[model samples]
Target: MNETQRREQLKKIIEESEPISTGVALRYQGETKRVCVYRIPLDFLVYNKYNGRISSRVKAYERLNHELNSENDEDRELIEKLLWESKVERNRKTMEDLVENGQMRHGIVTADGVIIDGNRRASLLNRAYRERDKHKWSPVDVDKCRYFNAIILPQDAGPRDIQQLETTYQMGEDDKLDYNPIEKYLKVRDLTDVGFDIDEIAKMMNESTADIKKWQRTLVLMDEYLETLGYEDMYPMLDRVEDQFLSLSKGLKDWQDRSVLAKANWEYSDADIDDLKVIAFDYIRYEQEGKEFRRICKPGKEGSIFQDRLIWESFRDTHFETMDAIAEESVDEEIAHAHADIDVVDVLRARDSKWKSEISDSFKNNLKYSVRRLDDRMEDAKPKEILKKVRDLLKEIDTEQDSFLNDEGVATLVSEINRMTYRLKRELGQ
Candidate 1:
């Protein structure tokens, strides 16, 4: 039989047979790849949004069990209310679409019925069943959802198996959608927190170990920085801005290294962390600007600090005094002071307005310093070696001269060559 016929056969088997009890030594019968449908009671499944104060599936089950067994009426009521609301919010859209189409896909569950996948669907069906009698206001028909559909796994499936299967079902499927950065980061972090080794997670998620570590590190540091700034509760502010946080991470390490190395010490100083805190706050504020901040921090942009490693080095080595503005007592105080005069956006824009000129000036000064040193060396060089070097330099100059399409560019190159030639003659006593 074809696929649809097989599914119909499975549905018939489910309807004719009694519900399979949990903890049974269930074995696969008939074909191994056949889809099996079971009408599981709503209480048998669990909801795990992978967020909130309860961080893991185990924790969610614990709260659920507490609600099921609690002697205190108030505690049970509160937990029940929370579960209902959370499930409704998460599953409402899926429920609406499924009912409208009158079709549902297969969901996976363990024998003990901790939903490995499709908790939202199960939750919606459960809600429909619970409210079936309250027909005066119920949106979903209770008669249609007396039991939830699922493909129950064997009794031996453990947490590792569940995690692996969920990851596969969510990420490995051809129809898989790209998760937003924050969701991806949180999922990886959650897996790590639940005792999955980095290499194991890398293999499971099809990501490099370094990539996994980078996400974890960025998340950990971002949380610490948010907590430092008294906005730990506001961590969702980082959603969709992983690049900014990653850039801050790199910038923080660079700044710390420079500050510590300047003191001739290998350990991080308290002042270094303090400076980092301020910069971290600045970075988050910049991220808040959304598109404008992205424009300034765009990787591979013309004069972006994030794009140009050399710009960061130049700022660190030469323009260190410019960052003194961020060296305040606290991020809060610095932010307040920043906004006390001009708005933060205006302040940032003003700095961006000067960035090109500042970078140009710094570049010219460094070039001038290099030229002076080269002049000193040329003064003492052997004439033959000098002539060979000058000839090679002239060849390079000629190659570049072909690309100088503008009149101003040609004039500048000719003038520079003349100045260089005059210097060479003076040095060689010509």
Candidate 2:
């Protein structure tokens, strides 16, 4: 058949075949014979998009042929040699050797093509074909090879189908594919199977975990940074930028100020930053797309420490105020009790001597208003009830006031209250 006729016939045959079908044909290249075959869709052709340059079917053939012709002496000696024997053997060998040795190569195919399903023998054949230069090789030998087989699939296979098939193939093999390298290299940290326990994967790659953690924190601040520059989508480009940051920050490890890192113009020039901002904004337009105020405040560890200390002091002062309120309430109740008991004179004497002497200036000032109110209440109450109220107020003061005061202050307050209580009791003959 003419070349055009042959192509037409191949297409027709492919159309007529079932969803997953196979066929074998011969094609003559000048005086050479070529084994042309249709493989079922069940076969897979794995190719790395970043690296593979060959067309899909051709790449698949090359990969398969390379495997068949592998020079590893041990692979050449498998005894079972069943239909799937080579594939099973290869998987075992790959698991035991390639995986542990980390010699496996990864690549993606840009096109869809026929692939051998877990057939190591077929892979070996394909590998051999790949090793032979197309211009120098004869197809007659391939046609003569009875062990070669192919499974064909429809051209319009869905991605889901391909993924399902790939997963099946992976499961059939004993060797586990190590996706960690790509994942780790892309992100400095990855959460383990367990929740919250983030594994510092970059550390496994000989990177510093602390630095990686710092970078992760930086990532959290990326949105803010991007906002400051009117940028967006800083996530996808994180890997590249992080590397740049690492290089820039390497010498500045001792610098606790993040501003130093932020100010340091490493790989990104002012112009580049503008350009990157535009690119990021375009890429991540879905998120809030502008510079944020916080992004400009790139504080380092020291800055964070300073901020924390300020907050702590503020909280301490607030707590002290709350404690003062509690103490004043207690003192008021005590004064009112003394007034009702008709022991106002005694109470006044005790308060001037004991309360004034024991409590600090701050505590005394807070108690002043409440003490005045209690003294007023004591004037209108019966003497006996006033005394009881005074005792009760003193006990409440001892319990609640102690919590607000410092340890030494509390001890002094308690001692004074005890002395007053004793003196009052002796005077009342109770």
Encode model 2's per-residue lDDT on 99-162: one tens digit a residue. Answer: 1232222211112432323334334444444434542445554332222233333345444333
| Top-TM-score candidate index | 1
TM-score of each: 0.49, 0.21
- Give the TM-score (vs. native) of candidate 2: 0.21
Residue-level lDDT of model 1, residues 1-430, one tens digit each, is 3334434444454568665343333223222354456765554444543422112222333432333332234533433444445445445665555545533665776664455666545556655556556534244544456556677676566666667667656554543343335555666766776688988777666778998888887887777765664544244445546777776565455545553243221344556445435543554544434443332233222223322333333433443344443333443443465646553334333443344344445434543443333343435677787678767666775545446655587779789989988997998899
TM-score of 1: 0.49
Where is model 1 poorest over a 10-residue stretch in terms of lDDT? Answer: 51-60
Which ranges of candidate 1 are over 4 A from the true structure? 1-35, 49-93, 101-103, 128-142, 171-180, 194-199, 206-210, 231-235, 250-277, 289-430
Taken over the whole model, the C-alpha lDDT of each candidate is 0.51, 0.35
Query: Cα lDDT of model 2 overall?
Result: 0.35
